[model samples]
Structures are given as structure tokens and as C-alpha cells.
Target chain A: MSDTLDAALRLMRAQAALVRRFDARLGGLHGVSLADFTLLLRLAQAPGGRMRRVDLAEALGLTASGVTRALAPLERIGLVSREPDARDARVAYASLTGTGRERLPEMLATAEETADELFAAPAWGERDVPVLAGLLTRLGGTGLRS
Target chain B: MSDTLDAALRLMRAQAALVRRFDARLGGLHGVSLADFTLLLRLAQAPGGRMRRVDLAEALGLTASGVTRALAPLERIGLVSREPDARDARVAYASLTGTGRERLPEMLATAEETADELFAAPAWGERDVPVLAGLLTRLGGTGLRS
Candidate 1:
């Protein structure tokens, strides 16, 4: 494989391992997948703790229908709620519920702890995080943009 | 979020986008998902184009059952085959068939092309590839070991 392909494959594999770790911890402790945590985190970062469905899809690199499907479970669990736009009936929003807000800090703590452990000690260098973040941003992984 | 958590989240999102792109192309062109392509590529790289099922699972970051479930469709499609260990009947190996070997180059070309496009142009700097790959390796991405 070409260098680019080699790197892309590595990225995929590494991400898979990372997700499995995150899911195990997040699911066992918080009853949330990494995906759910990401959704809640994004909502928390948004103004009024809500975002338009289309915008959320764009930010997460998912389709509009995918965003809807992802939101359904969170909505059912009362961790998220839907709001219809008053003027434009076609427009809708996803908002983090009070329950979601209350629970998110704990989730964030777990995720952060998991991440710190993953990158700690002999495995990672001091300079690695910024460099990796910059590289990921090039692939449209703009993280936690307020 | 801490810098570590931010980078981790970015990695997750970037991988998701990359997988979707790879899946769309690999699936449309080769009738294979990225996961299937990764399995085939790994087998192709193995000595004699085969590996023990347990080892394959370890390399792919999947459970033993996941390897079996993933192999089922490929085995049905003739891209992969099962080999009984002659001495140890309890152990099984996965081998890339002749058809698989023949077809892999084309699949690889498609993957390489897709990856190239993703990393091309103003978005990607020349130094980005090596830096990113090194970072991914720290997360146990290891790339193509053979």
C-alpha cells in the first residue's frame, strides 16, 4: 500500500481499538456509548444546549436521517428532547434534556480518564497530542467547536 | 475536555468519516466493506496468505466470534476459505483463496485511490502522513506488520 493508504488503515484500526475501550467503560458505568457521549457533548457545547438537526449532522459527519435515528434513543431515554421551530415548521432542533446535562459531567469525567490513560507514559510523548489533533482536524475532525 | 480527550474524540470522528468513505467506495466497487477489505488485506500479507483465526482476531482488534461472523460472508463469496489444522483439528486458519489473491490488487488500488484523494491537496501537508501514522501506531494501530 502507498504511504497514505497505510496511514489511513492505521488510523482506522487505532480508532476501532479506542472505541472499543471507550464503549466498554462508558457503557458499563454511564449506560452510554461513545457515540452517545459525543452527541451529548456537542449539544452541551451548543448555544442553549441545542442544535439544529441538519447542523448537528454536518458537525458529526453523519446524514440527516442518521442524526434522526441516533437522536431517537436519546430522546426516548429523556437525555435529549426535540423542539419544532415555531416559524419554520420544517425546521427542528435537538436539545439536551436536564437529565442529560446532569449526567454529562460524569460521562465526560469517565471519557477523559479513559483518554488520559490511553495516551499516558511510555506510549505517548508530550508533543504527540497537539500533532495528532492537528492531523485529525485536516480530516474534518474539528473537535468540540463551540 | 482535556487535550487528551479532545484528541481522542477527534480521532473517533475522523475515523468514522474515513470509514464511511472507504465503505462507500469499497462496497460499491468491490462488494466489500472496509472491515472485509481489512481482513482480506491482512490475510494477503500473512505468510502463505493465511493466519490462525485467533491471531487474525488479535490483529484486527475483534473477538474470535467477530472474526467468524465477518468471515462467513467472505467465505460464501469465495474470497476466503477455512483450513483445518492437520495436527490440531480444533484450530482453524483463514486463507485467502486464489480468487481472493487475484482480486485483492484491484481492491487495494481502489482503497489506495480513495485514501490518496482524502489526503490530497491543500488540506494535507507533506509531513502529515508520517506524523499521523506514528501517532496512530502509539494507539496500537501497528499498520501492516508483514
Candidate 2:
């Protein structure tokens, strides 16, 4: 493999491992999957803690149907609510409820803890974080916007 | 979010974007998804170009049933075959066929090109490649063993 391909393979493998770790940790601690946490994080940062379904789909890299399916559980648990857009009846927004805001801090804490453990591994030191983050942000597009 | 969590989130987003891009390119050019490419890569590197079903599942971070479901199409296309283990009738290995070997180079080329485009972005200088790879290897256990 070319050097570039070699690096790409390493990146992909690292992602798979980290994702598995994050998913497990987040799910066990917060009762939320990484995907769900991502959605909630995005919602938490949105204006008024609400977003249009289509916008959420785009931001979360989920399809419209995928956004709907993922939101079902959160909505059922009162963490999110479907609110009809007043001016456009056909358009509905997903609004973060008080419960979701309440749950987010704990979930965010778990995410931070997971990060600390993973990055604190002997293989990585303090200096490496920014380099990794910069490369990922460039590759990921939209930077840290999500 | 803490700096660590912010980095982690960026990494996750990058993985999602790259995976989507790779899946689209691989599927379009080779009639294989990124997950399928990963499986084939693992099989090709395994001893005798084969691996047990359970091993495949673990390496791919997929469940046993997920591996089975993913393999059915490859088996149908004659790119992969199920081989019974002589010592254990209950054990079966997934092996790459000659045709699969013939097809691998082209698919690999596509992956390389995808990596080139992604890494060539101005955000990643030549020096950043090794740093990124090293950090990812540390973060992603087993490194680039796949």
C-alpha cells in the first residue's frame, strides 16, 4: 500500500476501535448510543434547543427516515418533542425538552471521561491531541460545527 | 465540551464522512461497500487468505449474525467461499476465491485514490500524516493490522 493508503487504513481502524469503545461506554453509562448522543449534542447546541428535521438530518449525516427513527425513542422518553412549525404546518421541528437538557450534562460528562481514558493511553501524550483533532476536523468537513 | 471531548467528536465526524465517501466510491466502482472491502482485506491478509467466521466478526467489529448476513452476497458472487474446517466440522472459514484476488487490485486503487484526495487537503501537510497515523494507531488498538 502507498503511504497515503497505509495512513488511511490506520485511520479507519482507529475510528472503528474508538467508536466501539465510545458506543459501549456511552450506552452503558448514559443509556444512549453514540449516534443518539450525537443527535442530542447537536440539538443542545442549536438555537432554542430545536432544529428542523431536515436540518437535523443534514447535520447529523442521517437520512430523513433515519432521523425520524432515531428520534422516536428520545421523543417517547420525553427528551425530545415534535412541534409543528407555526407558519408552515407541514414542517415540524424536533425540540429538546427539559428532560433532554437535564440529561445532556451527564452524557457529556461520560463522553469527556471516555475521551480522557482513550487519549491518556501511553501511546498518546498531551501534544498529540491538537494534531489529531486538526487532521480530523479537516477530513471530517464542517469542522467541529456538529 | 472539554478539549478532549471536542477532539473526540471531530474524530467521530471525520470517520463518518470518510466511511460514507469510501462506501460510495467502492460501491460504485467495485460493487462492494466499504464494509465489504474491509472484510476482503482481512481475508486476504489472513493465513491462507482465510479466517473463521467468528474471527471475521471480531475483526470487523460485527456480530456473528452480521457477518453471516454480509457474507451471503459475497458468497453468491463467487468472490468468497465457505470452507469447512477439517478438524472441526462445525467451524467454517471464509476464503477469497481467485476471482476475488484478481479484483482486489482495482478496488485497492480506488481506496488509495480516495485517501489521496482526503489527505491532500491543505489542512493536512505531509508532516501531519505520520503524527496522525501514530496517534490513531495508539487510539485504535491493533494499529493497522487489518
Q: For this target, which candidate reaches the highest lDDT against the unseen true structure?
A: 1
Model 1, range A1-146, lDDT digits (tens) per residue?
Answer: 89999999889888887887899999999998999899899999999999999999888777788899999999999999999998999989999999999999999999999999989978788988988998888885542331
Q: How high is the lDDT of residue B134 in model 2? A: 74
iRMSD of all candidate structures: 4.4, 3.6
Error of 1 at A71 (Å): 1.9
| Candidate 1 ranges beyond 4 A from true positions | A141-146, B141-146
Per-candidate local distance difference test? 0.90, 0.85
Highest-TM-score candidate: 2
* Model 1, C-alpha of B10: deviation from truth (Å): 1.0
How displaced is residue B119 in candidate 1, in Å? 2.2
lDDT score, residue B56, model 2? 92
What is the alpha-carbon lDDT of model 2 when measured against the actual structure?
Answer: 0.85
Question: In candidate 2 chain B, what residue range of length 10 has the lowest lDDT sum?
Answer: B137-146
- Residue pairs whose backbone atoms clash in candidate 2: none
Q: Estimate each model's TM-score.
A: 0.90, 0.92
lDDT (10s digit) by residue, model 1, range B1-146: 89999999888888887887899999999999999999999999999999999999988888889999999999999999999999999999999999999999999999999999989978888988988988898896432231
